[model samples]
Target chain A: MDDSQLKRRFAEWEQEYSKRPARACETLSGVSLKPVYTPLDLPDADYLRDLGLPGQYPFTRGIHPDMYRGRLWTMRQFAGFGSARDTNARYKFLLGHGETGLSVAFDFPTLYGRDSDDARARGEVGKCGVAISSLDDMATLFEGIPLDKVSTSMTINGPAAVIWAFYIAAAELQGVKPEVLRGTIQNDILKEYIAQKSWLFPPEPSMRVITDIMRFASEQVPRWNTISISGYHIREAGSTAAQELAFTLKDGLTYVEAGIAAGLDVDGFAPRLSYFFNSHLDFFEEVAKFRAARRIWAREMRETFKAKDPRSWLLRFHTQTAGCSLTAQQPENNIARTGFQALAAVLGGTQSLHTNSMDETWALPTEKAVLIALRTQQLIAEETGAASVADPLGGSWYVEALTDELERQAREYFRKIDALGGMVRAIEHGFPQREIADASYRHQRAVEEGRRTVVGVNRYQLEGEKLEIPLLRIDPEVEKSQCERLSELRRRRDGARVEQVLTDLREACAGTDNVMPLVLDAARARATLGEICQAMKDVFGEYVEPPMF
Target chain B: MAKRLRILVAKPGLDGHDRGAKIVARGLRDAGFEVIYTGLHQTPEMIAEAALQEDVDAVGLSILSGAHMTLFPDVVRLLGEKGAGDILVFGGGIIPDEDKQTLEGLGVGRLFGPGTEIREIVEYLRDRFSDRVAEETGD
Candidate 1:
């Protein structure tokens, strides 16, 4: 471990590898990976000072002392698509398959707060995920599933409040008290404008709505994660590994500032705040990214925000296998890719994980496909024994080096964003957009030029490969079924109550009052998603992007 | 003049994932074609109207949800009813191969899936447009 011996070993390994030649030495984020590392590299590194034991300051190893030993990570298989009944069945199936938690993926119409029968929602009902237009649909979606037992994470952004209102109402109908209802609402609309492009209101108003939910949830749903600041979609949108880490942290910081500005203590709501990360193909990079993310968030939380509570400093996250990486060509190969990605998630110390199905590239995952995906995680947990050890790669020289490098690169991005006046300002200036576009372009060029091999894509030219895997096909009647349901709900609901709730929602939008309570009231009254959003639109107005270079 | 090979890049539904659409739009533009990107959440009527107003040579509808069967044919039928039948209507998404064939038979030109290169869409559009032009000129 001495400096001289470390140098000798590094040189010796360099000589040995020089003869063999490296397959690759570059991180996915383009950081150059040195062949070896030793004590010399960490001369200034204080192991006790830098990486204290888990659950301590600068908690790089993990948030908890005994991570998986205390309790295994939540296996939340993301489901929803088709009629509420169909999606409900899928949820039950996943739960039966040993899934510990539920992550609901809403269809496009529901995501945008549209009813299935809306002109804009024509062919989209139950397409990508379930169509929950009202509390009726939400109730149907969670029909038999006990609300208090299983935690749900709804992947909704623009209309997060409205959709969450429906969820709260549905839970209330099930006799689950607001305090007992556990789940997360991906109410991070800032990221929607930044990457996902799913914004209903402009950023300023959107932030206000999000802050209100944070304010409310801190008191009501104490166990619920108010906003899961997601880097998964950012990574899926073609960001580099470093970009994902940096942008995600930057976003997390923005939310903290927003919460503070909203007259809430930093530690009050910060403990419940969570993150969602993407587990991409590069195994080491993903692990390093996760480690660096924890280190940066913990340090910033304590030093910058002065968060007193240890729980406030912890960066708990949910990890999903990279969907963009799944290829329709050689569909079965996605299984291996998903397995490795899931393994990276486990090694990275994700609090929860969702492994993407092989046929996800074509449509919503078939049951068989989803079973394989879930089994991928089960195998990693039981057979691989990866869960037995906490941060198994923590002491490895290469992993530590990569982690340090990732932190440095991400800090650089953070500094750049800070210079540009934080995340919102940077988004306004289109800095993140341009960076991702350039990164996406570079990655595509690399694939085309054969610098990076995507198996069946850039390499392994399988001519006329017949896809053997069975792809999930949504019953075309699902759309009709959804439309019929929407039609019936409209006819059955009391027209007078719907109008009254819509008026109240519009009035709240026009005033400084918290609209989420009004949203919940509307959901309880069976006001559809489209109606509630339309009420808000009458006051807040719609979004139109300005053309720029 | 052979009419500037106009194409409409329309996001037909609520799926806001537009990276692929934007990339394809930029690709078509770079390939010497005029692409009218109708941003996000356009109804079938709006799409048909935009195509007619832009006088596009083709309409490229992008829908990621499994709603192409209902949405795609709606646009196709609306285009026909609106007297915009000559325009080639093509699209892409997470569509099953069987549905792709079905949509193509209903006058959709081509269905592009994930990993479908923009270069391929560009080449096909060019060849098909040129052939149409040639047939019109009796060449």
Candidate 2:
């Protein structure tokens, strides 16, 4: 029989059988779910084109032919907090425990381009992530970790170019050349305006800095993934999966356009560009979202931008299990949540992964909780048979259908974004931010109305929940000591040289020149992150996000 | 008629995690409370000043950068100095129990953590301002 007969039969079966428990048949992204999917559901299911071989063009199944069978996903836990010395020790600890790569989490001050001594850095010196204020601190941050041996990913934006310069200088101190260094910088600034909101300069100047990095990285740090076009923050900030996929890819496309506008070849820089996504709670939806992400990217790069290189069509992403999905109630339950999410990520063919610690909702995770998180990934990679095959769930009718639907939705968003004159213009008018706020409010309302079930939150009620887990406490003395070190560096460094390099940086920011070399000079001259940023800020001015949800 | 229940929902410190604050602000708004949102990267001084100027019934400060100890108490003290000490102070974020207790000791009202129902915060505010709400709604 055909689709009509199958639909009739499905309706008859539905009429005869009452749905048990009476749950809403829908994904977390609010896509209405059908009871069951048949082959008829995929009307245009062209297997060769839509669901191609694992490593072929339109790589919907997987980016690599033998994804995990050849090599396991890099288990890079994002580790940082306190002073550079403190975070450096943690890196050694993680490496000793079998972690394959390094991911740095910079503190609030450093992320915002401030030294610990800046007035704005008060009470926040080493609170969120590791503090790296100068080349000295960067050197200390990776004192023993050989930059050439391990691939590192830094979560920095706004001032990503300067921080990257500091990293290169730090590596050079260890006798590592720039060409041999392998790492990624989270330099996607479009999302900062749209979701994360940790911006420094206005969009035009920010884009200028980014394009400079793209050109510089292709020549100098060829192995480095210039910008990890991110959806992690967008998802964490409460967007549905469709928005995250659309906005992130749109941001990536925007960067490609920016690169081309700056007179760079598409194939030149596109190969090194990577992606970052969130492995959220809805397992199948997330898997489909990832598959759809790769396919959409491959198609768009091949068709839209006329990218000739097949490497430009690939969408290699690093996945971090959803931090928002973990509940504070029954904190231990987060381990299981993270485990499932991590598995979904691997099944979706992630290139690398970060599993959030159970106690992250309360504070920065303690040592034990961090270990449990790392072990969660190890279990999936080594013990569980999930990673043995590429795209194990690629043939599932439900996943395929969802993949089609998500791609359709993302394309619809791309049209809306294009009509609004691209993502930057959309962001200027707060379109994406408003969309995320509305969706987040809707999800909250669903939970409040008992339409959605959050395991420990709305259901399985735990009364007067006392989170007894060991919490990592940032030492208050961290701020005090960090300030002392900053003052010491300032007093000892060549003040005239610092001022001269900063002046040169301001000129580079104002004129049509790549600011990377000057930024490296400033980093080498012992100019602080704050001072270097201040020099550019004097020319570009700081960004002030209009009041938005 | 009595004035509407006015509350200030603000993000303090450098961290840009504003999802919880914005949700709570809208939740309180939907619950018939007037919420003044301070957007992102708000200083404690700015928050206290805004609370005083707006004459909000309470100031709800959110911080997840692990600087709650420094930011929260500073906001409360500034409020007291500005002579708006009666404005209820409360918020949500990634605060430990011990820090919560100390903040409570410093006259900050009940704090909520992640996964808190928006209804719970709504009810907390409703209970705190029961007199005004009853007078306004004429219940």
Candidate 3:
């Protein structure tokens, strides 16, 4: 049919549909969703310019031509709790159960650069994630797991470099060369300042440390991804989808600028820089956000930064299903939510994905719940056939329009951030924090006022719901044993050598020398995580955020 | 008239998850209470010291690192050592149901979990403070 006939048909359908009006709906980002979409919605879309062929420039379709046909996205589950030995068993269990890679989740103490026995650690030893204090704990955490055979992604930020030094030292003990090490350190501290709030040093020194890692990794650990610029934590901290994309990509750009300013070539380090995103409940909107992220990153790297290599232009990212979207009311329903969200990530061509377990809303997930979450990914990959093609929804008019709209919104944010000097300056001024707080408040108000329907929360309430699923309870004994082990380690290690290394580290932090080598030496000399962090803290001091309302 | 019911919002231990604590602080502030928020990574001793220095009537400790079993009792003990035992000590985080009773038994006033309404916390504080005032005044 031609334009006039299509318009007439739409008018007739609208008249009939209006008689039985459906409830209005909006996406998680507050974008209104239309009932029906057609060619008329995408007026400015150019087929070649906007949605290029897969593996080509402006890769809205995907970064690779064959996509999953070439190789399936890595099924990496984020798992860690208790001592290093305990987490190692879980790692072996996951790898035995068909997980493709490992993602380590450190506890609060480790994330804050505190040893298991520190006074501040108290009852937090291995509560949220595994506790890796010294190189010994790192060695135990990966006792039999071959470093060359599998890639690892560690989710620690403030003390990322120190923990990474422990991992490298552990690998060295296993006779693994730095060149063969494949993994990612979430050394993205800007996001820490913005959302996560796990920062150790202030922004300038933190950026210096991140640049040091990038330079060292690019030269020595060529296979390592230096930083996984994260939007996952930002979204989990209650930012909207557009805000997540914009703030994250801007953070990525800030890192790029930092690397360049530090005298590193863009292509040399940019290819290894990756991203982590959150796939929320809105299927179409999440897919569009992912697509727009790629397009925007590619344009900024190639056009703005004048990057020459295509590898530098690629926007490789890992995605995790949103944990904040899970409900404590009907915990079982979380499986279905995770399934749909994982499918969205897969369809959006994520390089890796971690699906949240059903019991996470209450405590750490049980082994049974983790298996279900893993099986959800397997079913998506093997049974659902969603992985059979690249960008299955690429040509849909609604998706394209949404993708364009998201790109437009992100560019607006970029302009605003640029006007505020940059992301660091914007964060220092509490721009992103205020934006997220406002959005969070607005969403909570919507839920409270019944304007939004959260299943099992406001509507379809179940009376006197009892949580029947088994919750994973970390034994308080774990903390006691970990503290004992740390004391034993301190007693065994060479105190004079540790002191010498720490003094050297403190000097390096005070000077302009790259501190990664000193950190590596300290790790090898049996310097505890807290000891190394304390040395730097003595030099760089700690970061205290301004009051953000 | 009772000095606006001063409260110290402290995040004890190493947990960096402070969204709930910040929200509650804001809630108390909007409810006309004087709120002093101690940022992340406060030890039990530091928290007690802050309570003494700020002269807060109550101390609200927010911990999500599953360290409530150790941190809560330590805070109470420290406050007692510092001669501030009469100050109200409340808590919140992802504490399980069974642990809630244990924490309360350890002298914690109340423990709020996720999805708790902000007004519920405000009301609980109001009622507790008013009761303490009545007892002191022999009403």
Candidate 4:
């Protein structure tokens, strides 16, 4: 139990494990794992100052003291596919399955601001997620679900402002006030440049649009989270855990600076600013990454912005299990992988969690697959007793050491980004892209060289294994039906009103006027996604990526 | 003198997800292949015109929109009408095994799924291109 005895036991255990040579013990970030850790490893650590009580300074433990005891983290299953009617049915199905919240995944057309009837959207009307080209589709997508009661998160960028305006206008149609609407827009365009590559305008105008939303949301949508600055897609694009943390926080800093420059007080909008992260297979590293994120964010918000509100300093985030980690070979093993990942998110004090389905390596998750995925989170929350205590590994020597090391690495990245004139410059200069490429290359090398063992990929050689899991197949007819719906929508809406609203939207974009209200007006007029986006494009112009990436 | 093998890498449909297409474009370029990527949300017509204007030896269509069953065959059929069917046609995405087989049967040169090593695709194209040239020259 004492330090010397623990160290002696660790030495003997390491020697034994080294002799076996079968199971390699290491962090997913390539950090070596020792058999045991002691106080000597973390000497200058102040528990209260560094890893304080929940809701205290630095707030590494948690943002809330009674994290899940009062109310469990929302089991928000990200669901949407096909026409609005189909996605609406899926939403009700998920809600019936005990899902706590709704997360919308729009199809490519909606994400890229193309109407279902557009030539560019021909075969992709409702393929990946739901297709919402007009207010009619938005109204149908949330038909039975009450906008005021249930929280919704829309996974959209590029056309995030227009999509969010549609949601707000739809909420108003349902008699819900903007101040009472609660959810997230994922309006972080900066991350789209870093990893997702779904950007619309150039960086300067994009940040301007983002800041305008931040300011408008602060004034109107008090309960809504304006921007969920995401590191999830970045990590999914093959970034290491530290890169996910550092790059995501750098994005947060960029948004903060933009918001401050827009003449808003930091404390006014900072509390509603949330984060979305990837919970990969590396349990300890993931936990440490989350803790370090909170510590770094709290310190920056307080020291840099001189914020007086404690609420403004907290970094509340939602965690989703990494979709890229699922293996198509021996897909059942993904269940265990997701279980452990869910455990990590819970232990990391995620405010909400979504465990990816096992069959996602193939297609959109099926009903059976998503139910099991939801059960994975439920099992950890109810059976594992992890939710009993906040920050269960707060005092562990290994966790503390890992957290400190991760913070150091992340701050080094922060310093590098700062020297390169922040995240936008760094992205344009291909710094983050090159870093991610190098990390992805290192991971691929490890898997090939047997330095890291993927369960069924390299070490576990099960050749010609047949997957027993049922794959989800989208009906080809869904596209045809969605196309028909778009045709009917175009036929029904008043053409003159739509044209006038789009003209106003274009003129608003051409001036100093905020585009959010104009976008909302366009949504209300049932202007198609392509029409609205083209209006803005005529003013802001489309982005041409520099010869960097 | 060896002529450059120009290829138009297009991401047709509304799929804003371009990680795979971007990576493959980069990989092909690094493998000494000239690649002109007509960014996301390109129509099949736009892609065909671009391929014609670029005078590409091949056109690689990348669509993850689950629309490849209809989209891939359209591209091949359009290329045929435009008298460009001799250009090698290939595609990649989350296509089902059965669908890939169907696409291949319908004259698609190759169908790549996830976890495909970049080298394998590059080598296949190299050998196939030379074989086609040899047949044409009666060598």
Candidate 5:
């Protein structure tokens, strides 16, 4: 049966189907869903052009041919809270529980480039994540964990370069070579201005800092992924899957262009660039988004950027189950939600995954909840047969159609972004922010109007459900100990050496020299995170966001 | 004529999570209130100064970083020091059930936890402010 015969059969089926009353249906992104999908739905989709063989160009099926069969996706849980020592214990615990990689979540002060003792950092020290103030803290945080053995992903931006320098210096203390360092820095700052709102400097200077890391890492730490261009935060902030994909890829393109402008070879740095995406509850939609992301990145890298290496074209990403979808009511239900979402990520061929713990909506996850979250991934890998085949849902009529539709929508967004002169300009004009706000508001209204049903939120209401899950509470003593440690370090460190290195860092920031070396020196000299950031702040100044809806 | 209700939405301390705060701010604005949003990394002093300068009738502190124990009371105290003691202070974000009672006992108005409806917050403000106006006018 060729195209015409399939089309005739589809028309006959639709005629009969249309006679019956249709039920209202749509995806999470408001894309209208059909009662059924057929091959005729994707008549123009060329198999060879649109989705080539896995491990080939335009890798929509999967990046590697064998995908999970060759090696399972890393069970990298995002863990960090309280002081460095406390988080190190958590890291060792996760590793002992069969976790493969480490993903660090920094506290608010660390994320914003403030020391634990900064007045603004009071009460927030080690609250959301580990507070790493200097090389001393970084060394202790990774204490016994060999940098050469475990691949680490640090989720920090704005001050990513500085934090990364601390990591490099700490690795030096461990006698690990820079070239052996394998991990990612969630160093994508464009997403900061667009969604996460953790930005430190203005866009122009931030881009410069990112490009400098690209240049330095390409030479020194070839195995390290300098930037994890992220859509996880965008989706968490309420954008649809298509918006997250297009905006994130557009940000990647912006970084690629910046690298080229800074005189780096496309293939040299592009291969080390990675992505981070959110795996939400809409399983098929999330899978489709991942497939479309690969196709877009592959084509853009090979054609648009004229990259020669196949590694440069691969769209490797780390996925985390959606945190926003978790509910504070009937919290146990979130375990099922995270399991299904993690399965979607596995089927979508994520290189790494972080399953959200069930109790996250109220507080950080307790030991039991985080273990359940990690076990969710382990079940999908070990028990479920989903990982046996690459792109298990590939070639399904509904999935292929959804994948094509998502790519079409993302391409339309790319055109609009290009017309607006690119992502930075679009963000400055409040394009992505307004888009997310509108989508979020629409979804909220739907939930309120009973048009959509979240399992325990608006529908299937449980009256006066008692909270029973154990919640992780960071001790206020964590803050006190951290501040005391920071103060003691200040008193014991060579103050004059810190000042001299900081002046050098300030000079490096003032000029065109790559600031990584100077920052590494500052870290080595025991210059605190805040002191090094202050040097850059003195030169670059702080960014104040303009008002937007 | 009744004065238009002005509210200041502030995120105190070092938390960068602002999705809830932004959503509440927009919700209040859509409900016809003038909202001044103090962006991320705001200290208690900054929040209190913003509330005093904006002359808001209410100040809503959105903190998700579990620092509500320290930050919320500090903001309330600063508001008093700035002679804005009459300004209604409420809070939201990840505050536990036990802590909610403690915060309210410390003169913080009703604290909304996760899964709270924006309309409920809007309604709470409407009732509280109208009661204040009636009592002051000796209705």
Candidate 6:
């Protein structure tokens, strides 16, 4: 039918649907939805310019032309708890079970640039994630794992450079060169201040550290992704999907600007800048968010930044299912929730994926729970033919409309961020933080008012429910042993050389020098992660968050 | 009218997951409670000090770093040592059920886990303080 006839039919359907009691029609991000979409929705959409084929300019469809038909996504379960030895064993287990990549989760002290021996680190050492305090711990963590063969992604923020140097030095001990080492460091400090709140220094020094890593990696560790600009933590901090998309992209643009300002060429450093997104509950909205992310990044890189290299335009990302969507009640239900969210990510064309375990809300996943989460991804990749083609739902009217709508919403956000002088200043002003807080509050109210139905929470009543899932508990002895090892290393390592390298690092932080080499030197000199971070913190100073609700 | 229940919401340790803490604080504020939030990275001493300084009747400690075993009990102990034992101490995070009971035994009021409604917390606080509120107003 033509546009007029299609409009008339849609109106008639709306009238009939309105006669019955219709629930609130909107995505989880509060984007309004229609009962059905038609050809009229794509009235002005030009397929050639807007969405060329996959691997072409403006990668709205997918990054790779063949997508999963050529290769399956890298399957990584983000596992780390207790000591490095504890996590190394888990990594071997995952690899033996056909896992493709490795991702490390660090403890709070390690993430915040504090030592295991610091007073603030007490009771928190090796509690939430693996405690890697020194080069010895990094070497132990990767002892059996081959550095050259496997890819690693470390989910660290404030002390990314120190941890990354440790990894490189550990690889050197393995006789592996930095040139062949492959992986990503979650070095996005903007997200730290805005959402994750693991920031070490003020925004100025953080951006400088990020650019230094980018320039160094582009030269030496050519295969390594220096920064995985993340929106996962932003979403976990309770921002809506559109907010997640907008704020994350805006952050990416700001990084590009910083790199350029630091006297680095855009195309040289931009290709190594990867992205990380959260696969939220809203299925089509999430899929749309991913597509829109690629499209926006491509346009901004090619048109705005004038990046000549096509590699710089592709928005390669790793996706994790939303952690906030998991329920502590009827924990088994989370397995299903994760499965659907993972499917949404794959359908949206993720390069890598991590499926959250069922018992995460209670504690870190037990071996059994983590294995089930892995198998959920395995089933999606093998049992389902969802990845048989590139962008399987590419031509769907509803999905395309959603994709365009998300792009429009994100561009509006871009304009807003630009007006605020960029993401760094916006974060300093607590703009994104306030936005996330407001969104989270609205979401909580929706659940309480019965507008949002979380199964086994507000909707289903399971009387006298008991949590039967086993939880992984970090041994308190782990903390005692880790601290002991740290003290022993302090006694054993070349204390004089460590102090000299740290002083050099401190000077580099004060000056306009690329601090990565000094960081690597400090790593080789057996300087602890805390010492190096403190050396810089001594100069750059720490960020004190102004209280806001 | 009787004074609104004063409660202090705190983030103890390096756990930066404040989505719940902020929401709970805002929810308590909306429910007619005067709420004070310690933004992030607070020690047990700082939290206890803030509770005393704010003169809050109750303190809510939010942690997700699995240090609840160490930090939760420490907060209670510090409050007691500070002669603020009458101040109610509760928490929310990934605390296991057994640990939750142990914490309650150590004098923490009603530890809410994930998926807890703000209304449940508001109601619990109202019920716990209703008698004191009555005593305040001579009801």
Candidate of highest DockQ: 6
Correct interface contacts retained, every candidate: 0.63, 0.76, 0.47, 0.42, 0.54, 0.89
> Measured with DockQ on alpha carbons, how good is candidate 6?
0.91
Native-vs-model 4 lDDT? 0.85
* CAPRI tier of model 3: medium
On residues A469-529, what C-alpha lDDT tens digit does candidate 3 reach at each position? 8899998889899889989988998999999999999999999999999999999999999
Q: Which residue ranges in model 2 land beyond 4 Å of their true spot?
A: A1-23, B131-139
Worst 10 residues of 4 chain A by lDDT: A540-549
TM-score of each: 0.94, 0.98, 0.95, 0.92, 0.98, 0.99
- Return the top candidate by TM-score: 6
Q: Clash totals for all models, in order? A: 3, 0, 0, 0, 0, 0
Which segments of model 5 are wrong by more than 4 Å? Answer: B133-139
TM-score between model 6 and native: 0.99
Q: Over the stretch B26-118, how does candidate 2's per-residue lDDT look in tens digits? A: 988988888899988889899998998898999998888899999989998898998888899999999998999999998889999887888
lDDT of 2 by residue, A1-549 (tens): 578888888788777666555655889998999777878778878999998999998999999998888899999999999999999999999999999999999999888988898888899989999998999999999888888899999999988998999999999999999999988999999999988877899999999999999999998899999999999999999999999999999999999999999999999999999999999999999999999999999999999999999999999999999999998889999999999999999999999999999999888888889999999999998899998888999889999999999999999999999999999999998999999999999999999898888988899978886767888999999989988998999999999999999999999998999999999999999999999999999999999987755
Which pairs of residues collide in candidate 6? Answer: none
Off by over 4 Å in 4: A1-26, A33-35, A546-549, B1-10, B22-39, B49-58, B126-139
The sequence of per-residue lDDT tens digits that candidate 5 reaches over residues A171-240 is 9999999999999999999999888888889899899999999989988999999999999999988899
Give the Cα error of residue A399 in candidate 2, in Å.
0.7
Per-residue lDDT tens digits for candidate 4, residues A1-549, read 486887787678778877875754678887777767877688698888898898788999999978789889999999888889988998999899889999998887788788887777777777788889888789899998999999999998889888888888888889988888999999888888778767778888888888878888988888989899899999987889999999999999888898888888999999999999999998899999999999999999999988889998999999999988888778788899999998999999999999999888778889998999999988888898999999998888999899998899999999999899888999888899889866776676576466877878665858787668777777778878877887887888899999999988888788778889888888888887788988888888887554322
Q: After aligning candidate 3 to the native by TM-score, how far in Å is the CA of A504 from where it should be?
A: 2.2
Candidate 5, residue A174: the lDDT equals 98
- In order, the interface RMSDs are 2.2, 0.9, 1.7, 2.6, 1.5, 0.6
Give lDDT tens digits, candidate 1, residues A1-549: 467876887788778888985666787768776766666656667786667777676878888889888888999999987788988998999899899999998888888877888877777777788888889989999999999998999999989999988889999999999998889999887778667777788778888888889888987888889999999988887899999999989999999999898889999999989999999999999998998899999999999999999899999999999999999888889999999999999998999999999998887888999999999999998899999978898877778877888888899999999999989889888888778867876776577566877888767859987768776666778777777877888888888998998898888888888888899989988888998988887888776554221
- Relative to the unseen true structure, what is the C-alpha lDDT of residue B138 in candidate 4, on a scale of 0 to 100? 71
Give the i-RMS of model 5 in Å.
1.5
**Order of the predicted models by lDDT, top scorer first:** 6, 2, 3, 5, 1, 4
